[model samples]
Target: MDKLQYDNLYKFLVSLGIVLIVLPVAALVFLFNMEPILISQADYDLLSDFSLQMIATRNKLTSYFISIFPWVAGILTCIGIVVLLIGIFKWVGLQKNLDKKLDAEAAIQTLNLLKMSSAEVAAKIEEEVKETVSIEAPTPPVSSAVNDHSSAMNKYIEIEDLCFNYFTKRYANKYSFERNIRMGKYCYDFIGVSKLNNIDLIVEIKYLKIAAGNSRMIYDVFERVYNSGVNYETIAHRNFKCVVVIVTPKEELPRLENIVETYCKAHRENASRIEIKCMAEESL
Candidate 1:
């Protein structure tokens, strides 16, 4: 275990041992040394010997109970404290594990972007515009290109890395991220994680353009992707965001954006945390 965890365990065990050892001994001491005030003060007033003996017995019984009750209460308090600590420890451990699904953190993303410059950003914007005027309608990915999209995948990953790093700058240490992960039936291209809380982001990238005629498919894809993001949030009791990316000709961005915005408006409730980014390959 890490130092933080080891310290917590050590403190809990020591507290438990102290309670177990000290309480009983303290209770016994109180019982043995307890003085019966009223009974002792009136001992001489009792005329019947049997009455005096009964009073003495009652005083001793009362003393024992007085000593034992507080000790029982103390023991209960200690037990309760231990139980609460266990629950809290378990909760922290669970939070730590929640982000384990993602191997990288926002700080790492930021470090990778340290060498990037303003010129690069300007150049990328220009590239996106040029790419838009160059390519025609959404054509099918060549069977060869479709065979292994790893190069395109790397391009999207690079863009996502930059986006996440810039997005989570202030809370860099409190977030984690991953790429090309399978949530369920679908594989999300990127995922952002929250370390301090249960909020995460899911991202999917498309290297081709969306057709206007594919509204049903688009809507269903959004629903499935949104649900996939929610699945992780539900399991970890965190909030989630769903993002869709399109790497198409720059001219086609407006059309794809409209389709996504329409779907977002239709599913406003679940789509509140949903986002779509339509860009050209050169932009990355």
Candidate 2:
């Protein structure tokens, strides 16, 4: 049966049982203590029996009950007590089961809420990624007088955004990411913290100029990211990891792998903690 119905039924039964027990006990008490109020001794005697012998026998029987009133009360009271205990046991069992069912239902609701929140976050991140990708460079370059690296910085900034969002999809609701993280001397492109998984992600980005075929770019990019990761790792506790994303032309993929392999050979132990992601320039 439904828990509420079960509870109401047990409560009603307990209350009814109490009333039944109380009324009988009250009637017995009044019959003994307030006998005059119920029916006076003079009236009882005047209501004549058929014979004097019969009247004396009835009086003897009545006196016997009066003498054993305590024993009679004790026996009836024990029966009432047993009924009360049975009702109490039934209520307790019903309530305990109800509590467990309620707890289970609450847990299910919490899990569903987490799933909904994860879906919303995933949706928002996807929408922002599309917007970032669709944004084309301005016609005029904003101004001709800007710093030499200013254009370079502007060009690769969306690439940075793309990389951050890429991992955000993989991590989903498990981690929360922040961009332009400035802590401990150097500014990091992104930092993702996941308390649930006990993990921290340090993301660094390098947009390679594959058009110039700068083979030295591989060495420079790896060195820079490795240094930053080492510095971050100094203060980082356990479960610290790094991802270095390189945006390059499709032609330079082999060169990128060679550089990473060389680095890994020299530092095999730390290699497991670091990961690399290479992307084609056109894709971004």
Candidate 3:
């Protein structure tokens, strides 16, 4: 039965037991008092001995009741124990149901992840953009290519040899790679002291074209890196550094440096904290 129905049934049983136990005591009391009124005067003399013996017998019965009172208490205690065991069993069943629900949710998430395609992922990205636009916080704009490059760079930064040398030179024992770590989600780009010490870093290289849009893209890259560092600082309590390196054609180095300086200042970060290095055209 349901919990409420079972509770009501138990309550009815308890009430019935109380009534049954009290009725006999009340009857015995009444019977003892009625003997005096019911007995005749002529029979009183001869019946005196019998009445005395009857009274003694009643006393013995009362003694028996007193002795059995503990048994009634024991029965009630047993009922309480049974109720508690039933409640525990129900709780265990409920927990099992909850576990099944969680397992189903996990399975659904895995299936959704497997079914996701590039187009669908892009649509999800656009939806995320719209949602961010609706929020009060400033939304950082990132291009699909930049996003992909950033993600890849983050993966490269977690390389054992790279992360070890990167953090050991600065903070020494302050950071340990013994523990598993991740990028963006756990740590930011590989440039902030907080993130580098606490988590691994990502180094991204953006190849720029000689166009106005490319110049703007370069500026955005710097912004993305700075934002990543800011994000790490805001979330991570440990000390680390994430470095962003930009590789451009030899001719574009001067302009890139200027843009990097401007972007760093705009983001309220230091230029020295980031490495804007130029590499050979083929090297990039």
TM-score of each: 0.42, 0.43, 0.29
Residue pairs that clash (backbone atoms under 3 angstroms), model 1: 132-250, 198-238
lDDT (10s digit) by residue, model 1, range 1-284: 12223345545554564455556667668767978555454566754888779878987888788767877867766775675576567656754675553433542353244323445534433443333222422453577555334444445446656555544574467666654454334445556666665566676655444345555655666677788777756544557778776655577667777877887788888667668766664565
How many backbone clashes does every candidate have?
Answer: 2, 0, 16
Candidate 2 lDDT by residue in tens digits, 1-284: 12223337666556655654675578687776854324577787777656557767877877897788767677666676676677778889888867655544443343233332334434433433333232322233445525533445455656777777787887866566666644455556676665344356777776665424443544455566667766755654424577877776678666666666776787676566678776776775
Clash list (residue pairs), candidate 2: none
The residue-level lDDT of candidate 3 at 146 comes to 60
Task: Note the Cα lDDT for every prediction shown.
Answer: 0.58, 0.60, 0.47
Q: lDDT tens digits, residues 1-284, model 3?
A: 12232344444444444544555556557656664445666766667677878877987877787688667656655665565555556656665666655544443343233344445434433443333233312344555546744543343333323434544575543322221223344322223222122333434434342322344555555556656656544544333344555544567667667776666677555555555654434342
Give candidate 1 misplaced runs (Cα > 4 Å): 1-174, 184-186
RMSD of 3: 16.6
- Highest lDDT against the true fold, candidate: 2
**Candidates by TM-score, descending order:** 2, 1, 3
Regions of model 2 farther than 4 Å from truth: 1-150, 211-238
Worst 10 residues of 3 by lDDT: 188-197
